[model samples]
Target: MAKIDKSKELDITIPEEFALRDEVRFLKSEDIKLFRLLRESMNKIEPAYVATYPPSECGIATFTKDVVTSVAKYTPFSKPIVVAVRREHEIEPYERIVRFQIYKEQRESYLEAARFLNNSHADIVSVQHEYGIYGGPDGEYILDFLEALEKPAVATLHTVLQNPSPNQKRIVQEIIRLCDVSIVMVRVGRQILLDVYGADPQKVTVIPHGVPNVHRVPAARVKRALGMADNAIISTFGLINRGKGIEYVIQAMPKIVERHPTAIYLVLGETHPGVRKYEGETYRNMLIELVAQLGMEKHVRFNNRFLSLDELVRYLCATDVYVTPYLNKDQITSGTLAYALGCGKAIVSTPYLYAEEVLADGRGLLVDFASPDSIADAIIRILDDPELKESLEAAAYRYGRRAAWFNVAVDYLGLFHRVLNRRRLAKELAESAQSTGKSASK
Candidate 1:
């Protein structure tokens, strides 16, 4: 037996003649016995993931890392290989697990990636899909890679638009066609795929966004340790941009502080790299101005840096209430909101597609989009009613347990197994047909 070094790229080249001879030999051998052994040993093969991984400061990157690492822990697959997607200017050191890097702007990189996967020992490939991560118009460059790859692929969609342009619709439909299965975080996204994009309903699966398995800790203890003992903390954390609608949250804070004098809003996370690149702190500067103009300087604090999972968990634990005042109503997935729910925090959010579903059945409160008054009222209501806050937190925590990374990883592994089984069945059928034709000719 050979030891597979996951850190290095797999060297699985096959000579054309050797491959043909092996196929003939395989068909002539005891087919049932071979099929049974392959089925039994399927669990031993590890799947590779294609995505933007850590050393790249993208949400999908962090997400791919967590999912792959967690799945490796919970399943028989031990060493998860990563084909990391990289931007042209962003060069950073990657861990040994990253087997290859796909340059975002390089068309040839996609073809190279497809070749790498086809030649690797991966049972299947899991692609973490986000439009902005790939190159070309509407990220159509991913099609080249998906089309070239010979192995099965399972794509996890991060964004599913309700109404997409023709080009956008075509891109998604094509990707769906290429993949063995398409996974979305919410049912709404699945519906959009079926109704809007005309994807095969049977091909889509809903797996909730995975959250860290953090135990519910007392808010007071965490707050006290963080030197926020005297203030009632309200927090929103993620990569910040104009779409976050943080200005509305800041506007809502003055009223919140008036009612509960010690109430403080903690805005955690860095300005989004893309936003910062173009606008250069324009949105953030506007938010700061809004805070000052409203005379809520004492009530608002900004932590302008990307937070580690531990740091994020601590902040969520310390929060009395979590708020997401996103302007985008069609947002289908939010990792920050999912984390807060996992930590069992009372939440207030705009009526986005994700929030409407997750906060249903009394898990959290929803406010009208862009309405500061609604945001303020919701926060005050949660803070004033202790029983309500407790109930919301309990409900969220119960739901969060189901979305914990371990459980989500299991769901992913099951999907991967299905794709692999389907691939094997197709190959077997094709080989059987080939053998039958040869016999007829003889």
Candidate 2:
């Protein structure tokens, strides 16, 4: 067995292949220990405002909520407030959370909201960047917001497009250029912006998304709830969309069943709301028909409902082999991959950019893109090779423990501290320069 470095994913070294944007390195051996000391010694820091899209019915919204809660609980000094377009999913509204509504028709309203947040006592403004959510191709609203609030801001890039349009590329680049510090969930994400989109490499930071302790129910308990018995289940979780390439997984299923008759393919999560209008259950219906055509109706299960966090964790734990057949190569942060890693489940995914970076730790299997045969081969290889499965499980378990939410929170704190320090330094330099100029004039 290979020696697994138990440091969390966020702490993992960026592969030398990518051009690093920010000078920020994942915690060094000494730095990790230092952060531990700071964690104990430092006073609580309050974040005045966090700017993300409205708390809508989406993963980004859910992640934003979790991050805010974590920041508040972990940082004693900072009680950060959420600046949102709309309060979409408020399971429990906290007093620290504030809302800023921006309708599509009102461009001036967006500026006003930005001004309000800027004028407030917010120390650092953290913006979650996804071009689709903001206005125009290059996130013009982001520019407006940043301009309005000359205060220091950090951006967490959520979606890095694999094939970006000219305008989309420009917007992402502009956002990266303007941000004081840019965060990405994975190194692969940073590379896309720098290498592919030609964005400034010096401003980007890698802060892999963290797993919350809230969803860490016992594996057996979770599996039992899903009614998954002793059968080996290979499941694909998350919103169903064209990019997910779920049909490829379904295609690979027939071949998998030929070898392991008891193998079941569980297609979890709902189709994305954005794509439902054009595709209206067409993909799900097609997969069902394919299962019937392939004569493996019993071997496939379609749990096509929007699963709560608890249920999703149960499904992840219950799954023997998790398959991500996404066609998109630029997908950086996959919630499915994180949950699967959290459960320490063996993964078999297509060769997406993040998959290569993640699987490099020997945590999972990666197959060629858009190839059903390759996908089937990877799945079968895992099932047949006990040693391989054990190795993957062990590696994944080691990785998951470090990538846990608390560890991620610690890394984020480091980033916050860095940005704050940089801002202070810049201010000091300006003041010094001003003083020197006045003396020269006299």
Candidate 3:
């Protein structure tokens, strides 16, 4: 069944005789030891082993993995168990890249993993809250797991819905009630949770997702290496889904080309597994069809595959401007949005919850969602006005400095410490109450 297509096969040939060169950035033994010491110091606290409940495949899983990795590097004392419900085909993606063992099967297995974490010495368990990650139909299992768990827990809400199903609303409310803490990524997301879902603000903490400090290589070299022309490239990276508004971006492309003639739209990343509504090549081919229909065959490019962190950094830096025309109101924490900002690419995004809030600080340009003309106009504004472009780029980099991984790591640690302190106080209170009752009995 594995038919090899010569046309589709990538021609990625490296020269054999070329010697690899190093720029002599070697660290001294003392320096190495200091680095290790620093890394370990950050991770020294005995964190209650965390079991992150995330979807099988998609950005949520990727973000969860990144959080685990960041915690391991900086907060190494925290043992993390990543529980996933994966299909046979999706298994390799996790195995090849994440290198962590994941549990596969139904919602019961997910609950079992949560229960196991609860029974363990884990101080706290963190669930990456998204409706799709929980059980289908009734969504009864998430509540069941929470009720079963005796240990303190936190639920990081990945999506903040504008109009949620009654069941979705109920489950989310129950989650908020069950968990010790609820963390969100943006201000608007927090607002939506409170206003729409009636979540208590006291319970929710707004900590933006941090972007790792990735090296930005020159676009010219990367483009040449990738066999692409030395031209201005615009990129939109993330799994392709209908709610992502990729089709609208493609529609905006013709107009963008009319202004910046040589501009190419490079859509990086693949279809997310959570996007069951538009699975596999269905969404991809539809975008391709739109590209062809718009006569943007030469100008538009697609990379429907998993990209290494280095590759992602390279492509993001290579982009002249990044576009995220998402129509989803629920996308609260956008790693794509963060990645674009971190790279300091002059961005044009729809006024989604995060974009509307974060970009208000003038980090990036914003347009109305679903309006191809609005997207096109924003793209043209950046392309035409160098002053504006530079302003946005500088602002983005400034914002990135604050939103860096190290800073975010510190914030998460603070939250962890607070959660631990709260737990300690609760224990003391319970002991006091019990001791008083014993004295009364005596």
Candidate 4:
């Protein structure tokens, strides 16, 4: 206890002998109950309203679908809806959740989509940005949409080229300038946006690509289920395109087969719809011819179908060593590679931007781009040493757990709430200041 100083004259004073007591306080049981109620109320949140890509054959569509589903688990109050992006000539029955549609090739459609979003009840407009998904040269029409948009926006860039053209650079800069914030899957992407494009450093965030919350199934069990129990499986799964460098994976098969006759390389997924539309199946045929040329027909098989989510997971679980032989060194993101990371398979990949980051620290093995010998040597090392394979898978699985969809979804909600709150605060402050000024003038 400390005695109060009553010696001096004051407007308010304690008694001459008054002393203040200091003691630790404890909450009553009833107060604790009230506190619990208050905490629960604080933790509860309203659902986020997002308008972005819907389910389709595109990998971006699949990613959007996963985002919607995963985000729903954390916020159960309401559901997230979509605004599907379609080809100019396509008309298909979309889900009821799809409130509207935007065509890829029509310039007028972008403005209309913007109008629709501004009038709608959406809280935020999410742009699943890829160069081909939007209209105009280098997707310039998206800039129009963002310009006209009144609602807050968040742009998730699927591709961030290291060396972009003048138009590409301009569009990306405009998007960051217009949107409340922007998201990229890797740190290198954030760095590129800063160093190359001069994007606002504070505007960009790095949230990793999401992967399904999958249970690890034993390779033998899944391999037997797929009728490949006796053979070792090395596989790549993604929409086939010239950029995938499938030919290198094929070329590596002859050498792989020489060491282990039962080793099979499965090339999964159909030709990319965009590639099929523009270039036809020339790339697929070339890969088939190369496989035949090597006399590795039985060892290398192609599953020419679009794999459903379950099917993709099954194939990944069955894979002893997963391969990603992407040729583009500047390629920023790969959904298939993210999935393989999630599945915690022994990954052998060309050192593309994403691979170099995700596969670092022995999480996976990296090889030279378009080099079969490099890929073959990496795969053979994993196959020969069970302990090494286990070590790689263990490390990958640990990392993937940190990047699970659930965590990613929560990160998104956190960012959204922070943004919304800051805006709300600024508006309140401005209104209060205006009211004070009016009162002072009187």
On TM-score, the candidate that comes out on top is 1
lDDT of each: 0.87, 0.72, 0.71, 0.80
Q: lDDT of model 3 at residue 190?
A: 81
> What's the TM-score of every candidate structure?
0.89, 0.83, 0.82, 0.88
lDDT (Cα, tens digit) per residue for candidate 2, span 1-442: 1232334112111123221111113333447775566556755555544444322556776677767755655654345766765423434233446655544334575677777777776777788777655554455666666667666778888888868888777777777777788889888888777888777777888987776453333444444444544466799988888889887877888889889877888898888766786879887788789888888788888877888776776577767788989998877778778768876888999878777787777899999888889999999999899789878877876777777766787777777788888889999999999999999999
The lDDT-based order of candidates, best leading, equals: 1, 4, 2, 3
Error of 3 at 201 (Å): 2.5
lDDT of 1 by residue, 372-400 (tens): 99999999999999999999999999999
Cα displacement (angstroms), candidate 3, residue 203, comes to: 1.2
> Residue 335 deviation, candidate 1, in Å?
0.8
> lDDT value for candidate 4?
0.80
Candidate 1 residue 257 C-alpha distance from true site, Å: 1.3
Which residue runs of candidate 1 sit more than 4 Å off their true CA positions? 1-42, 433-442
lDDT of candidate model 3 versus the reference:
0.71
Please, what's the RMSD in Å of model 1? 11.0
Which has the greatest lDDT? 1
Residue ranges of candidate 4 with Cα displaced over 4 Å: 1-55, 439-442
